[model samples]
Target: MARNKYDIDEALDSEFNIKHLKRLGTYISPFRKDMAITILLMLTSSALGMLVPIFFMKIIDDFIPNKNIAGIVGVCFLLLVINIINMINLRLKVNITAKLGQNIIHQIRSDIFTHLQELPFSYYDDRPHGKIQVRVVNYVNSLSDLLSNGIVNTITDLFSLFFIVGFMLSIDIRLTGICMIGLPVLMALIFFIKRKQRVAWQIQSNKSSNLNAYIAESINGIRVTQSFVRERENIQIFNNLSKSYSTSWMNAVRYNFMLWPAIDNIATLTTAAIYVLGVSWITNGVAGITTGVLIAFTSYIGRFWAPINTLASFYNSLLTAMSYLERIFETIDEEVTVKDNEGATEMPPIVGDVEFRDVTFSYEDGVPILNGVSFHVKPGETYAIVGPTGAGKSTIINLISRFYNLDSGELFIDGIDINSVTIKSLRKQMGVMLQDSFIFSGTIMDNIRYGNMEASNEEVVAAAKTVCAHDFIMGLENGYDTEVNERGSRLSAGQRQLISFARALLADPKILILDEATSSIDTETEILLQEGLAKLLAGRTSFIIAHRLSTIKNSDKIMYVDGGQIIELGNHDELMALEGKYYDLYMSQYDFLR
Candidate 1:
């Protein structure tokens, strides 16, 4: 499945989408005041830039021709002042736009993260973790260039283009006409190149996501890879993914680099044509053809193409950013499959009576994992569920916690429909510990206190003692303060399980779930841990899923499940007396138990 996810091609939508642009604009709406000031600054800077060429024209046609030293000096001073103002406005514009861009990206990243948290577990079940991480971190960051400089600079370039065109037309309409012969050609080239660039960029982004996903998966399974001596195979896979990413990047960059030279060639050719035509007209003594006018027109030609070149570059960047925007919005616009319904209220403290009324469920496909399963447990009862590997034991626990919604029936806790109450309220009263206990990178104390943030240091210690974790914890160099490296890599499996027990105990939940909780511990350790668990489960309703049947022998009710159906339900002695499926399972492990 991971390979398939990595192999999927990222197809781009339209090259330049106005809808995506408008949606992006909504992020900037909150900082309108900053954006407005930026726009004003951009206009002022561009206007000043346009005026500098006009001043050059004035020096050539008016001040220099009139032999007016005082006029030339005054014009020079005025040009200097204009340039100073332009520089100031440019600086302020950059500062404001950068801040605005960062803020908008920050908000977008935050929204994506918050929304991801609200999505159903099924959403994650169908996606790769690294792919989602890329969208939140890399794709959103790609918008910074476009937001910070692309929009404002593109507008400024347009203004400069117009101002230069108007000034040239006012000077000599004939020359202006000749200089613009390359305009249509340049526009066509840009349009053609933009489409290809968009496709290339989309491919590049997809490859990057694939590479990241592979890296994340590889790093997570490095131990397994090494243990199986498959390092060479993993390296080969990584190299292939990296090569693909590099190829896509090169393709995108080829189009980007292609545009600049294309624009430059056109600009250069147009400038040469203007100079030749202006000189010929002057030699032929055509009307309105002066040396000053010719020189100024030459200067205006450079200014004209400068903005055109800038706009063309901005167009390329805009296309690339549009691709990133499409990916980002795709994630942000995903419908949250699970959420609180309207008028849903918080549930009061639970009494731990859980009931499943003919609950049926499946994953993405409609093949039922739990079909017409019905059960009920009274408050403060310990219900043990024993089953084969895929016989729906854990599915029952998931349903009781409302991690998933029922397909055909209802689940109730303390007589209240679970779906009728807020998810937060429903989950707050339940504590769960699974077989693959996850330990975060933090001090042992912090990891334990994670179950109850408000737990004091004393409470944390007490909980650790209750779970038989305090003795080993105290033996460590830092005791409770010992940092468990990422996923508790420094600790043994049994040590991690003990800490998980402490975390669940800290919560003081009304209901508890232990899924193979003692499977990793040795018999000696399991015996001590069971002592702690006995006290922990004394008053709370508990569900235990265990392959080691002895761990659940004391459960008030033991259920043997097979093929998503409860085959036997009785106490330990009663099930043994029946000599049915339960008896056979026990007999198979009888030698080990003895």
Candidate 2:
């Protein structure tokens, strides 16, 4: 079944595969000693437990019948000792497995988060942030129970089944066969329910993810919604998503709740059959059919079905947890498309000379964003790029940052091919300020310090002053120490951009990119920031993208980009003299102002 939802769940392999089990060995491998001890403890406790019913049978048959009080008391003491041993085994098992489970969870979470860090921008560009957050936080937590107790209990139960069956068959082959009737029935029930249950849970997972994605998006865009008077419409959409989630959840749990009753019914019917047949056969003076033996056989029947019940419950739990694991591992297994190539080296000291030779690229295959465009920028020069929206202007800055690999041609930095160096080293030498300035939840001092962690507070203050942010920041009650929330909602748009300027310049990068850096500020503030911009750009190669022609008229050189290629390239004065596309663009803005 498919639902009309924003988050489309990827198809999972519904068929049960042993590979999932094998894959678990990677995490469990670290705590092999702990696992071995936990399994041994489980088996030992189960063994001790199996002997209880037998001892009870002995008391009824051999001890009380012969008036042997001493034997009864002796067996009673042994049972107490066995109980104590079982308790100890359980305590140890919980301690070891609990610790092991936590460690495994940490490792798996760390691995996913680490992989996410290495994954290219394109990975996140295609998915919602909330969907990614759920996998990292929710899906990993779901594995806790299965990792903690399910594995050991499953192994111990399987062994106990064998031991119990052997003891039963030795007591009476005919009765044992009668008890065996329920095993196939239980298996058949699971066989029928397994696929439906898995599919139901998978759909539930999809709905949950969709609901989370929508909630996150809604919260982030609440300001827009309120301003546009879309609150009622948004609430209606949210209600629909909530209802869908509730329905899918109930459907999944329907299959989950069905197992216990069916298993119990089969066990109840099997036990009743045994009692009727045993009593009738004994009345006919059947050979080797003593009262004690009949009692013991019934006792073993209860023992036999208990594990089957547990296995049934665990089987259900396994199928449910695997739905979550499928997503978790799928994320872990997502290939790091833009990572350090083999034997990639640290980038050498940058001189800011940048060149793109016949470079081609596309966010989607066959839908090219940049078509074989090429350019060269000399060190210490400031270049401004002007273009209409979707004309691949920002794509150039991103290419220079090496956030994306070229689709075909080569991009070189300081005459070195970009792909030959490690990404961390490459990015460290350049500073980029995007249109949206994201602030972490911390003191303003900490936010600016994020650029260069080793910079002293004095350095941070110096950078803030250079960006014209110091006057407003000092105007606050706490000055640089004032706390700000993530996304910087407390700060004005212009103030945030000023802080962003401080952050970008704090790194003292050789190459700097400012994409619409001053668009949000008024002309008066923009004029003040230009002095700070002059200081920051001294001896550094800079690329500025802006629609306001007044801001970039004095750029060392300007390139009017359009239709996936450069249409005009010259200094501001030269471009104005050419009276081509650049002149038309500048004249239109000038005419509007005039």
Candidate 3:
């Protein structure tokens, strides 16, 4: 299926001021009925609130003139009752808005997470981990605020404007007309400020994302920065990003801070004009222009300014909030290039025979990483692939696991093309240990069990024993319970490798790929690892990529790959007799020994 076309970066800038938000409105569609009821209650609250000024007008115009204490008390009590009801309605509206915002954000976060998991490894290769991390966290946070607070404030402001205007006209039409005279001017100002605010907010969000991306990269590569003594350079880069972020924020804040006061000053001037004109008319002579009516008009005027200010401030808030929404929507719009085929079947159990038939592959177009490579590893046999640093040895292993597909060719495991089977099932039959084995932060037992989460404690201990790691594990302070700090920083390189070895051992796959596994370990640990390897490769089909020929000397076959093609294939002794690529690589190491 073709992918959705949503520009995440642009959306972030515009704050999702697009058709998608209208579509996303459907998420709230389910609760529309409840929302309707809540809005009705809010309207009722607004209506009751308008009655307060009328009650005061009545007290001043009628009850005060008649000197009726009972009437005065009754009107005051009704006003109090209306105030209580309005408060209750407002609280309920807030609660409902809160729930709706949380639900939508939760749904969005979950969908993005699922999409990330479904995306191909190529997508990961192009984007950094820190960049993805920021998107998942900060983007989701922005979406929640936009949907929740932004929507609620907007609706309330509209309703308040409607209710206030209607009540003012009902009380006195001419005075109401006079109060609304400056509205068009205020609105034009608001529109102009909104544009400026939106731009500033966009700048702020972009700068912030850039700062976060840099921080993430710097911290992850902190070791390299220190080793190369690039700390000063890195700090200068951070300072530049931080300055841009702060400047953007301050620009947005400056505009936002000025907006409310500007609106207030305009409203104050309008209110003063109304009071002066109304009083002059009352003294001179005009219809329905009583002192009480003038006072009530002033009260309504004050009420109108509050909502207008709220709306103006909300416009600024929307820019920041919407920018966040755009970023989140962008991620949701991302295409998952790698997805399962509709009729893909689960891989059945196999005897681990593998074949690459006239295979050609590349990580990039026009540059082949492996070309016309054809080889086979029979069941229960060990095969070694010897190659120069970038001769496509690891690429071969990746192809076997289907981490990347062939550009033009077929890969078969037990005579079935791997693409015909579900990727999860295909991977289930294989175990791999890369040159740089990663150990996550967790207890030693937890890290090992990560290979197969359902593995029993007994199974875990047995796997550790098979990899010759059990004794060293027991000698640690807390044994298997010892915490492996972030990236297993607390453990030595050899110890980390042993733990990874134990992890792979626990998986118990029919096919195993070990790439330069013994190269990084100390001699003592190397001996322990070799002993473990003997037990591991005994009756399983294995593929080994190693720099040390001694590690794979006893393998059934050794294939020497050069220039993306296998130049020679034979057992170790046969390769030595040929005195070709294999002999040269072996002798180079022998010279170091001499």
Choose the strongest candidate by lDDT: 2
TM-score, each model? 0.95, 0.94, 0.91
Q: How are the candidates ranked when ordered by TM-score, highest leading?
A: 1, 2, 3
> Which candidate model has the greater lDDT, 2 or 3?
2
Tens digits of per-residue lDDT, candidate 2, 1-594, equal 123235466567656666776787799899988999998998888888778777887888899899999999999999999989999999999999899999999999999999898888788887888788878988888889888888878888999998898888878898999998887887887889888998998888888887888888899999999999999999998898888889999999999888888878888898899899889888998886767778988988888988877887788788888888888888888888888889999999999998889988899888898888888989999999998899999999998888888899999989999999999999999888887887888889988888889999999999999888899999988999999988899999988888887888898899999999998888887898888788778899999999998988878989998888888898999999999999999989999999
After aligning candidate 2 to the native by TM-score, how far in Å is the CA of 506 from where it should be? Answer: 1.4
lDDT of each: 0.86, 0.87, 0.81
Per-model clash counts, in order, read 0, 0, 2
**Per-residue lDDT of candidate 1, residues 72-185 (tens digit):** 898889888988898899889989989988999999899889888888877777777788888999999988888788777887788778888998898999989988888898
Residues 1-594, model 3: lDDT tens digits: 111111122233333365656756867687677667677877788778888888889999999999999999999889889988988988898898788888877777887898888777776776656557667888677667667766666676689888899889988888888777878887787777777777777777767777777788888789889999999998988898888889988998998888778778878888988989999989998888998899988999988888888787677766666666666667778876555567999899978899999899887789998899998888998999998988999889888888887899899999999888898998887888887879999899999998899999999999988777898899999999998888788888778888888887788989998887777677776777677789888879999999987889989999999888989999999999999989999999999978
Give stretches of model 1 more than 4 Å off: 1-4, 10-17
TM-score of 3: 0.91
Off by over 4 Å in 3: 1-17, 29-41, 86-96, 190-200, 254-258
The 10-residue segment with the lowest total lDDT in model 3: 1-10
The collision pairs in model 2 are none
How would you order the candidates by lDDT, starting with the best?
2, 1, 3
Q: By TM-score, how accurate is candidate 1?
A: 0.95
